[model samples]
Target: MTDLTGTSFEFPGEYYEIMRKDFRNLDAETEFLASLLPDAGTVLDLGCGTGSNLRALRERGHRGTGVDQSAAFLEYARAAGDEGISYVEARAEEYRTDERYDLVYSLFMTLNYLDRGRLPAVLRSVRELLNPGGQVVLEFGHLLNFVDSFQPNSVGHHRRDGVLITRLARQFINAHAANWRNEETLLVRTADGTVAMYDNFFDQAVLTGPEVRELLAAAGLTITAEYGGFRKEPAPFHGRGPLVIVATATPADTASDTAQQEENQA
Candidate 1:
């Protein structure tokens, strides 16, 4: 019941990077993404927080554009001075560009943040943004994973460069609605011995395997692969980890014909 929401300080991008450093395997993740794309291909990162993945991909010789709604995260990403990588402030679902990409990816359970009703729009946008033979990689929290591993409360502490951050988390699962709520409080101490607290919360829709497949299909995408983690571990229907999906867009002509047919029928 500890709520740090009363604190005035907003979560900064520097601290966000520090918080993720402990768990996020940047090399493995970038390798996985690289394996999916051709050499020197263009990439789009939806909900790309702080542009970490894009920055990593840029180093691997790929050009990347990242879109996120958080201005603080975008500001930090732009300040990194990474060549061939750019950051834009926009919601994933509403983001549109004349530029097509060889690959589009969303990571870190970003899709789960959207309501179920909004998934089609997001997926459709992804499909439209793909170049010929383009693919999309999505990472989301699977319902089974949450069911298998549900911890109500946890605490973590990280220290770097004279900054100490203590994070407390609480989670609630509503099976009936297939919803997961995570609340977090962070106490950050600077080198000057000044301390500040911040609170964050997320409500996620835990979609079933079938629901995910159906949504992808509805967006004119075909699943090419599925994985349980960053490694190429198979994601069985009853898997117990975050779902990583690889999908390719349907042929543009075919998709266009299907849309025309549907419109005519309606």
Candidate 2:
């Protein structure tokens, strides 16, 4: 098992489209996220894989830059020829830019790939990159989802353009910590009857609702809303769906005053 700690799991760039095709409702998700911003808003996509969401958002009249650590994914995204979308290869925690954005979003449990030590830095970077009153949206697996509905093993098969791909997944949860491990094997068969196999594994941290709120607050962000899914349903403290968090930077003066109070108390 290849340990994928603090990195995006390795997946064949060419197979990304096929693997992710039915995994998400791209149109609905784009509409949901776009409704949060003004017309023609500038956006930043953190951990943007293959720039799919960025492309969809671009089509909705929004221009954005995508940041991902995978060169292969970035290369594939750039080849799409989207006029206003730009790709940057960088990890979420280390990515910085002089251009502030009206909205910054990281989706599909991207932040979970980071452990507790790195998550704060990533959140702070996100806060610094947002414009005044700008929003940050994140989608991640919550503790409840993992604890209550985790499936240990699953298999999926997808075929596209004369290629057949089969994915087998196994999950292991840490009983003592807010983390889990996933092992995956991919089998690909091409039109010429050549077969290839790949095996890898990754770890993810699962934070509870309160833990997530606390982390965001400590990063100088205030949670504006939470949803259970893309449909904008109220987020339950315990559930089986991913948590969609919408937050904005706390007022500078307010954050400063709070920090001062904490120091004085200490």
Best by TM-score: 2
Candidate 1 residue spans exceeding 4 A from truth: 1-10, 174-176, 236-238, 252-266
Candidate 2 C-alpha error for residue 195, in Å: 2.6
lDDT string for model 1 (1-266, tens) is 43221112237888888887886889889999999889899999988888899988888899989988788888888888658987888777778789999999999988887767789998988998999999999998887887887889999998889999999999886666677888889999999999998888877788877898889987999899988888888776665778899999977787788789989999
Clashing pairs in 2: none
Candidate 2, residues 135-180, lDDT tens digits: the string is 9999988887888877799998989989999999999877566578
Quantify all predictions' global Cα lDDT against the true fold: 0.85, 0.85
- Count residue pairs with overlapping backbones in model 2: 0
Estimated TM-score per prediction?
0.88, 0.91
